[model samples]
Target: MRRRKDKHHANHERWLVSYADFITLLFAFFVVMYATSKADQRKQAEAAAAINSAFQSLGLFQSATPTKQLQGATDAGSAPAATQDETVTPMNVVMGDQMLASPQVQEDFERIKRHLEGLLSNQIARHVVALRIGREGLIISLREAGFFDSGSAVPHPSSLATLGQIAEALRTTPYDIRIEGHTDNVPIHTDLFDSNWELSTARATHLARIFIVGHQFAPARLSASGYAEYHPTASNETADGRAQNRRVDIIVLPRVTTPASPAVHVPAAKPAAIAAAIPAPTATAEATARPLP
Candidate 1:
């Protein structure tokens, strides 16, 4: 008889607990997916912008110096054709080749080539004599035998006029100049030059000193270094290539910043150095370190 009376049961909303958990997980999943998608978009944009900027900067880019010439001028070398456009591709630009042709730098390789043709003609033109002049400045190259003696970094008397001519031109140009000395695969051992490296450096310094003292180049802008058999424009396999490799190179670059204040040596080099040092981080740095960071 008691079974007929159904006890009043409490309404349990236990299903809401599971529903809330599922909703919470869904929200978190959506948040994570949104973050990942946003990050991917930003990264792709950044990469696209970088590629675009590099193309714009380099003179080789069609936009920088457009040429329908490349339209038909598929690479004769190992590089592939510009098969696609609108999408960025490595074929659009070659980093190594782009570096060689600096926008601010005018490779006088052509002008120097012409000059050599007029002067040394076929003899030197067949070799790797080069001239690189640009924002970094200018470098005129001559092979060891072309400008010096066997196993010697000393300049031949005949080459003095050539060097003098370069210095004279640069006197009014006002760009800082460095004479970099290079040598071939052969190791030079002599009393005057401890090794080929020293010989190359000394020769470069020798020319630099002359340019500064005689031609009135700012001493601050002049420097010299010798790289013996380290940097070669050509191969060392053949005698002709070796001759080309054993040479001097000049480098010129633009001044990105103002000349540093002349060092006033006091009892300590610290005060001036400290004054010249870059300012430390400010309050803005902490603000940048946030969840958004």
Candidate 2:
């Protein structure tokens, strides 16, 4: 009788199953590691792209391109000391120290100047706005004619782009934005828009909207108002002066630990030439304020 070889097999191969199981575990571990590594790489790329898009859109960071002569800016840490006393010195130098400090603020201004030169050149430079940094912060101004069409509330496309750049530069910058819209003395009456009051109001709102909505700037830090044909920078007596009268200002305030402006209604000052707050003038005075362009 075939003495059933009593299953002499000592089940020596049972260890093979254990070994196979161990191999599977090791393979799975490597796969997980590889997947995690790839995921991390993807996340980094996405973050870089987002930052690039943001900077480029704001004109704060440009692609590889040559800077133009009109562009009057120096690097942040490399600007020469301020030498032009003729240039208006910042006031209440308080905010300057707390946030940007004078040197950094000046650097920002230079950057802005260079950016503006790239976009607008000197044709509008005389009318171009100034970015003033002080203890209170930055004061950005836009001559009305350069920003809007006569008697209309719509923003010129160029103005919108410039404003976009400005917004980007101030992103996360802690400075509050004050949008001030001013109009000339001429009575504005268009079929679509009724009066300078309405037009000016619309313009201010439009600029504010770009920051609040387009750029997602904080609404709490932003405010807007219209000076309907009231805050004239030049005498309204002449076309040139009247033209100079219109403008928009974006004031960037410094970090204020306490209540600052007893009132937020400071009148827009006259041209840089006069260096004083002046009233709207008659048409004749406006004419004489500037020679024919």
Candidate 3:
């Protein structure tokens, strides 16, 4: 057999790979540059107009007294009279009109905070109970160590008095109450609780029951949710952080005041008046949905 001649094939397509990669990189660079460019002026104006309209429609903006009156008050150095006219317009108005964004509601909220602070001074000093006024509303955080035992949903007997005090303070308010339960990232399995979800829900439900059954809070205004290590305020990698994450938060809904906004007139209604004005209770224990973990 004849010896096979060695054949050499010259490759011409080797450079295409590098060229394609370069084109892809160039396209990505231009895309990034375009994405970072300033937005169009017309678009910005439209966005601003839309936001203002939405706020107005939602009644989030309350117009204060005229500029002349404000100037007069400033010159006189005396507080101007409150402009909030407690005149509920037509009954067809939205329920948002009765929200806790008025001066009276703010006073009530402050009064509640002061009373609770005085009653739970020891717990507050021990860092077991923390009170904060956030945009959502007033938040009362109860640390697990001070409220519940490990793997247990029932709060300690010693903390019952504090809870009772809190209930009494809020008994007369018409704002809705939301009880939230959170846990650390550590996985827990017990006979009573199969997972953190069950544990957290049980804890929140038990606390809500205290308010509903023990304190006779209106079931319509009270609700509960279990976050189950999903809404931690601190890192779960450290001991102290985990401790901080595992807690219960009671959020009073519809902020009483927006310190960021100008002083404006917004009417408020008392609990009894609100109860009479508002329709029947719409919120129920069975209506609350359990979010997937």
Candidate 4:
């Protein structure tokens, strides 16, 4: 019995150990994957919250909670019915409502219009000037016949008095003034100008300078632009229409809403000083007025 070594018995249970280890590792791997998925979901929620807060701060989104709730409800397949009152108003609509509700702005516009009508009665009757309330606020149109000679940027000597009067009236108001120069389609090539664009711009700048230097208007409150052969109030096919097209428009812009501060009172310039500051009319400027064809 000693001479014959006992034959080693084959152990069938040894494979069970490796199978148990494999099952444990598989369970652990699933646990780790579940934890990672949960963490990613939490991060995504935090990122969404941060983005919503930023948009809310910018006033681009009214409420973020509603959006999230809507998304959640949609995902759950039970979205709440929207009510008519819950409809979101556009930003432009709200701004328009606020502007319309401003009674002070309307009152100021009406007062200015009435005062200008009274002051410019004579010129209005002669068709040398016109005043109207437009979408852009008050528009005071100065016909070319009353201000500048044909193809000339220099204003007539008589026009300076009228301009001074107008400037005096406007100085008390806080609104900004925009001077726009316009020209007819008739092509122009002159010593001082190459085309209608140059002519129109020169006319606008000249008037702006008169306002800033002669009338002592605040430079910040003034702007100038030129539209040549375009933005025509009347057609360029006839003499009268062409004349109307070749005019300068003074537009008074509405006041902006801001924190209340003491209104600055600029002293009015004397009539004599204003006249002196204006450039003297040239001989060409004094030439007989002729309608542009």
lDDT of each: 0.54, 0.56, 0.67, 0.70
TM-score of each: 0.54, 0.46, 0.56, 0.58
Q: Give residue 141's lDDT in candidate 4 (0 to 100).
A: 94
**Worst 10-residue lDDT window, candidate 1:** 284-293
For residue 157, what is the lDDT in candidate 1?
59
Tens digits of per-residue lDDT for model 3, 47-86: 7556644553333332222223322325675764443522
Ranking by TM-score: 4, 3, 1, 2
- lDDT value for model 2: 0.56
How well is each residue in 103-209 modelled by candidate 4, as lDDT tens digits? 56568878998998898899999998999866566789999999998988877778988887788788778777788888899999876677777777677777887
Give the higher-lDDT candidate: 1 or 4: 4
- Candidate of highest TM-score: 4
- As a whole number from 0 to 100, the lDDT of residue 35 in candidate 2 is 100
Off by over 4 Å in 4: 1-101, 256-293
Distance from true position, residue 114, model 3, in Å?
1.2
Name the candidate, 3 or 4, with the larger TM-score value.
4
lDDT of 1 by residue, 218-288 (tens): 56656677777777777988887888877877654332112344323223222233223323223232211
In the order shown, the candidates' Cα RMSDs to the true structure are 18.4, 18.7, 17.1, 15.7
2 or 3: which has the higher TM-score?
Answer: 3
Runs in model 1 lying further than 4 Å from the true structure: 1-23, 26-128, 132-138, 256-293
